[model samples]
Target: MDNRTNLDDYLAELGISEADESVTPPPMPDASDSAPVQEAADTDARGTLERFLRGLIARIDPELSVTVREVDDALEAEISGENAARLAGRDGRTLGAIEVIAYTVLSKQEGRGDTRVRVDIGGFRKRQADTLSKLAERLAIGVAKSGEPHELQPMPAAERRVIHIALKEHPDVMSESVGEGASRRLVIKPRHG
Candidate 1:
């Protein structure tokens, strides 16, 4: 919520009478407000998530019903079949974009710089993660057995990070991030060298 909106709600919750309202409401903070200004902000993740979903659904596709939540250390978003395909995007890239936007908006609304909101669109991300993890495992094994470092194709940072972390604890194999931006990937090799 914006500062003005927040300040307004605070005044309302205090039950300011019409006679007392003339005394002037609290001045809303300006853009120059510092980090401590977050103290007055609303951190209600569920309520905010609900409002965001309603507004997003209204703008995106009114026919589609979207259920959104910030739960289990991730943002879980589900949309009805009416717009699932449209939201799913090409192999879920669009879904990834939606997650990014939701995380950002939620973070801003929550006044937190570090947020772990996970957005799932029609469970596409979950299923995709499983598939990518398997693929990474298979590639890692093949590269390790070949005695040659292998560079997998480019993938989103989230997917690549998953692969990197999964291979991090392996005694016989290791992973490194390479390339730039979305083009980045993982290079897996035998841990000995």
Candidate 2:
């Protein structure tokens, strides 16, 4: 049998059937609902994220600890412990993968379809953002002086956003994303008079 079939059979043996996944979810609250309702939803989303991360971290490494909190409109989760570095992998590819998975899982749950998730292991994401911002600033200065467009190394949409935001208010240069998918990158160009 295929891997998917194997997984299904495994779950069946564990008493988790496809029927268990079909429970109907409650209707979403109206936008006109009171502030307390929205606050409750936010709290529920945070609790769900925290529980999900705790289970995932236990599977990866029981020594790792996960803490989730609401940051603006997103759920920010920090994984730290003796083995937290293992989850970061090379250039944080593994951490990125986990974040994507977490987002997908949370988005599929009732009342959480719009919830955003950000997973960071050992503050890697914050450091990366800071580095990208600095790099964008330096590149913008160069483009302003040379009066030529400079293409940045291909990066994910999030990193490209960091670059774009960093230069959005610059007087002499602007940034734009080019290409598509994995090959997409940012270009810094001088503003014309």
Candidate 3:
């Protein structure tokens, strides 16, 4: 007598017969395919992210377009369209969300590591950075003139980073972050003589 465990026999042992609809067997692996499918999937993270962002933009508005490129270890995506500002939202929260979603999806792919994706719409991020830099310089100058420390409204880590960088080489003022979590902000103080 032959002793073999077939699909029906195994399912029968587990009290699930061949007629059970919920106990279907999984699809068999493709024997002819020898490539590293998992690695292949992650090898084109930038391209995948570009496609994903474009699809997302399509859902928001079909007229929107996104251009993505690899900048060192990060992906920079620039979006242009009539509804681009809608993606930017107030203080770029919407754009940030899109980046987070893209990164999440990319990182979840097999073999991904330390993903960085930046999303910008119509150069809004550049304009915001420039405005923040100018504000940081103005605050630093004011602090130096009055010999008093000035505190800026709480901002996201990225904005605070811009402030610190903008004032890092200032002649008469220094910048630092204070507080915790969402309450964290930038403080400009007169440099000690």
Task: Give all candidates' CA lDDT scores.
Answer: 0.64, 0.75, 0.73
Measured with C-alpha atoms, the lDDT of residue 69 in candidate 3 is 80
What's model 3's lDDT at 38? 51
Looking at candidate 3, what is the lDDT of residue 179? Answer: 100
Report the lDDT tens digits of candidate 2 across residue range 41-148.
787667656666765665557788888888888899999997787679999999988898677556654347677788999788889999999998888888888899
* lDDT at residue 17 of model 3 (Cα atoms): 54
Q: In each prediction, how many residue pairs overlap at the backbone (N, C-alpha, C within less than 3 A)?
A: 3, 0, 0
The C-alpha local distance difference test score for the whole of candidate 2 amounts to 0.75
Collision pairs in model 2: none
TM match of model 2 to true structure = 0.75
TM-scores for all predictions = 0.65, 0.75, 0.73
> Which candidate ranks first by TM-score, i.e. highest?
2
- Residue 175's lDDT within candidate 2 is 87
lDDT for position 152 in model 2 = 82
Residue 123 shift from truth in candidate 2, angstroms: 0.9
Q: Write the candidate numbers in order of decreasing lDDT.
A: 2, 3, 1
Off by over 4 Å in 3: 1-43, 110-113
